[model samples]
Each structure stands twice: as structure tokens, then as C-alpha cells.
Target: MESLLDISKAEKKNKLYDSITPNRFKRTIIKDWQLYVLCAPVIIYFLIFEFGPMYGVQLAFKDFIIGKGIWGSPWVGFKHFERFFTSYQFNIILRNTLVLSIYSLAAGFPFPVILAIMLNNIRGERFKKIVQTTTYAPHFISVVVFCGMINIFLSPSTGIVNFFIKQLRLEPIFFMGKASMFSHIFVWSDIWQNTGWAAIVYIAALSGINPELYEAAKIDGANKLKSIWHVDLPGIMPTIITLLIMRIGKILSLGFQKAYLLQTPLNIDASEIIATYTYKVGLLDAQYSYSTAIGLFNTVVNILLLIMANQLSKKFNDVSLW
Candidate 1:
């Protein structure tokens, strides 16, 4: 009886151990060893560069002294946040960031999709390649050079834009100094420079669509436009949703460099976004803690917006980032 009980207990222990052991990790390693090797460098890069600096986020909660460092700094629980909320410029900055992001999202989001659709529909490969190359060339132009070109072209004196206005017998619009024109210039320039490059992913997705679907549509006497609408768009909807999620994720993170370069004294009111505000507080004014708090706030808002957009998209379209 004791020997039989011992055997039963041992069998139960073995079964428990087996149940707790994970198989997915072992299977993943066996199936994807080569892929894992390729990803090792990227993992190391993120570890060294991205995750390495996450500790500095503590600066957001402290009154950081130059000599004291992050750990030695005195904690000022939410003081900076309070100041940020109460400051007169807070609303202005918030409004500017939202307005610019919304406008850019509305106008710029569909451009790459349209461009990809058009490029895919081009039956002549040579003409399509030429068009693609021409559109993509602008992406290689450095932002400094691009902004300079914008400034020169919009210059009231001897600029091509002004010259055109002169021909039309209308006043040359001042693009740089005008607060009203700042957002327009920023959004339009962003579209022109990025639309082609962004379309590359969509075009790649479109290529993966099965040829049989198009053939079937042809048999049914469906036209090119109809085939594209029914087959190609549906095939690439997943990629579209994924990219849209990413775009929404970065809605608040407008890079400071271009806006800073493009900024003029007259346009300051309209041009001041969260990123620029952080730059001014941190780099220019040496208020590191304050800037860190502001940066954290901006990040949280962006994340919330991304989550909300994803949830809404999932509910309506049955597509989401998750």
C-alpha cells in the first residue's frame, strides 16, 4: 500500500511539472533561431540606446540640480505639473499642438494612400517608376535645405511666388511672418516631402494582393477601378490600420527642429507647440525639471490619444493596432 501511494504521488508531481513547463518559448527558438539571431543586434541597440535612458524620466518628478544629479535631486511631487497647468501659455501651446496635429492628420493621412493607389493603377511600369522616383526625390532633400527653399520661394523680394503674384497683379503673400500661413506651410511641406516615402509601404502591401482575385473580377467584367476598390483596398486595409495607429501614436510629438528653423518672430504665437515649448524651457532657459515634466505630459497625452483612436477604429472597422 505505501509503495503504491509513493508511485501515485510521483506521477502527480511529474504531471504538475509538465503542466507548468512552457513549450512556446522552446518552439519559438527551434523554429526561428535564424530570425532571432538577426534580431539580436536590434535588441542590443534598443537596450543600449532606448531603454538605457528611461531612468532619466525620474527628472520629471524632481527639482533637478546641476550638481545633484537625478538620484540626488529633491522630489517636488507635481510642482512642475501644477505650474504647467496654471501658466498662461499652457492653453495656447495645447491649442496649437492639437490644431496642427488635427489639420496635418486630416489632410496628410490620405495623401500617401491616394499616391499609392494611383501608382499601383499605372499599367506602364516605366512611367510608374519615373513618377515614383520624381516624387521620392524630395524626401532626400535635407530639412534645412527644404526650409531654406521655402523661405526663398516665399520671399517678398524677387521670389518666384512673388513674381507670380506680380503677374496676377495681386499682393505677394508673406508666408514666413504671417501667423495664419504657418500651419498651412508646415502641413503642405510635410505632405510634399513625405507622401512618396510613406506610399512605399502601402505599395508593398498592395503588391502582396493575390492575382487570382483580380482575374476573377475581370471574368465578371469588373473594370480596373472596381477591381482596385474591391480587391486591392481590402487586401491592404490591415496595413493601413497599422500605419494609422502609429501615426496617431506620434500625434503630439512634432519634432522641434523644422518648426524651430521655420519660426519667425511674427509667427511665434501660432508656431509654439509642445515640443518647441519644451526646448525653450529645457535648452534655452535651463529649466530641466520643468521641461521634463512638460515632456512627460505631452507623452501621456499622445499615448491616450493613440489608445482612444485605436479603440474607436477597432469598434467601427474591426481593425486595431493590438
Candidate 2:
């Protein structure tokens, strides 16, 4: 009976080996060794810099005494969140962040698509590259330098904008100093700076579309505009929808550098956003616990927004990040 049982176990082991991959995971690694080697550095970087610090996230709910350390700090539960939620400036900060993001999104979204579509229609290669280069140049400028240029160009005393207004016999208005004008300037400037680069992806999508559709449309008596309406728009709609979902996911995370650089006593109300507020609270005031809590809240909201946006995209267009 013992000999028969040993034979049975040997047969089962052989069957298992036969059913699986020849060398299992080892074979895969050996076959794609170069690809794995290439990806190793990125995985290491994320593990070290991106995910390693997650251990300290608990400080958000702790008193965070430097001497006591994050683990030894006293847990205070939702105290910090309660403070932020009940603060007088909560609504104001939220409003400012949303308004800037929405304004930029609404204005910035369509311009790239329009630019790509129009550029696709251009038959002259030289003129198209010239236009693309001119638009793309602004995106290379540093945030600090870009903001400084804005200040100089919008200066009421000697700005070219004011020079033209003075030529028209009108008073030189201080554009940057006005709260109401901040959103418009920020949105329009973002559009001008990023439209060309953003259009690159859409243009790539348009290129992948079958040229035969355009020829068919042309043969059916469709004009230039009509051809684009029938062929180009539908072909690139997936890319547009995908990009829009990403934009919506990041709706609240406006860039901190530009907002901080552009901030002033005059435009503070409009320019004050969660990113700048988090910076000031965390680094400047040294309220590490409070700042961490606020940051965690921001991250949670962003995740929720991303999930919601993904769901909506999936529902409408059957495309999603998940």
C-alpha cells in the first residue's frame, strides 16, 4: 500500500509539471529579460520616492511631535479635518479653486481640438510648422519667467497692451491687479501656452484615422467643413473623451508654481488655491499635522473625482481608466 501511494504522488507531480508553463515565471523573465531590466529603474524609483513615504501619512491624524516621531505621536482622529471643514475660509478657498479650474478647463479643452482640426486641414507644410513652432515655444518658458513676462506685458504704465489702449485714447487699466480679470488672464494664458502641445496627441489620433473615409466623403460631394464634421470629429472623439476624463480627474489640482508666482495682495482672493494654501500651511507655518490632514483631504477628493469621471466616461462612451 505504501509503494502504491508513492507511485500515485509521483504521477500527480508529473501531470502538474506537464500542465504548467515549461519553466513558469523563470522562462518569462529570461525571454523578456531586457524589457524587465529597462523597467527595473522606474519600479525602484517609485518604490523609493513615491510609495516609501506613505508610512508617514498617519501623521495626518496625529499630533506629530518631532521628538516623539510619527509612530509615537498622539492620535487625534478627525480633529484636523474638522478644523478645516469648519474654518471661515473653507468656502472661499474651495470656490477660488473650482472657479479657476472650471474657467481653465472650459476655455482650454476646445482650443486644442480646434487647433488640431484646423492644422490638419492646412495643405501648406511650411506655414503649418511655423504656426506650430510659434505656439509650442511658449510651453518651454519657465513658470517664474512666464509670470514675470505677464507682469511686464500687463503693466499699466508701459505695457504694449496699455500702449495700444493709450493709442485709442483710453485709460491704461491695471489688468493683473484686478480680481475679476485674474481668471480670464489665467485661462487664456494657459490656452496660449499649452494648446499646441496638447494638440499633438489629438493630431496623432487624427493621423491614425483611415484616409479612405475622407476620400469617400469628398467623392460624395462633401465640402471641406462637412468632411471634417463627418470624418475627423467622430474618428477623434474617443481621444477627446479620454483626455477630458483625465482633465476632470485633475480639476482641483491647479499648478502651484504659477498660482504662487502670480499671487498678490490685489489678486489673492481669486488666486488663493488649495495647493498654495497647503504650501503656506505646511512649510511656512510648520503646522505639519494640520497641513498633512489638508493634503490627505485633497488627495482623497482627487481619487473620488477620478473614479466618478471614469465611471461617467465608461457609461457614455464605453471607455474608462479602470
Candidate 1 lDDT over 1-322, as tens digits, reads: 9999999999988766765567845765778899999999999999989997688888899999989888999998999999999999999888888888889989999999989999888889999999899989899999999999999988988689999998999988888989999999999999999999989999999988888999999999999999988988999888888888888888899888788889999999989999999999999999999999999998898899899989988898898877
The TM-score obtained by model 2 is 0.89
lDDT of 2 by residue, 88-198 (tens): 777878899999999899878999999999999989999999988888888999888899999999999989899999999999999989988888888888887899989
Query: Any runs in candidate 1 off by more than 4 Å, and if so which?
Result: 1-48
RMSD of each: 6.9, 6.9
Best prediction by TM-score: 2
Native RMSD of candidate 2 (Å): 6.9
lDDT: worst 10-residue window of model 1: 19-28
- Extract clashing residue pairs from model 1: none
Q: How well does each candidate superpose onto the true structure, as a TM-score?
A: 0.84, 0.89
Off by over 4 Å in 2: 1-40
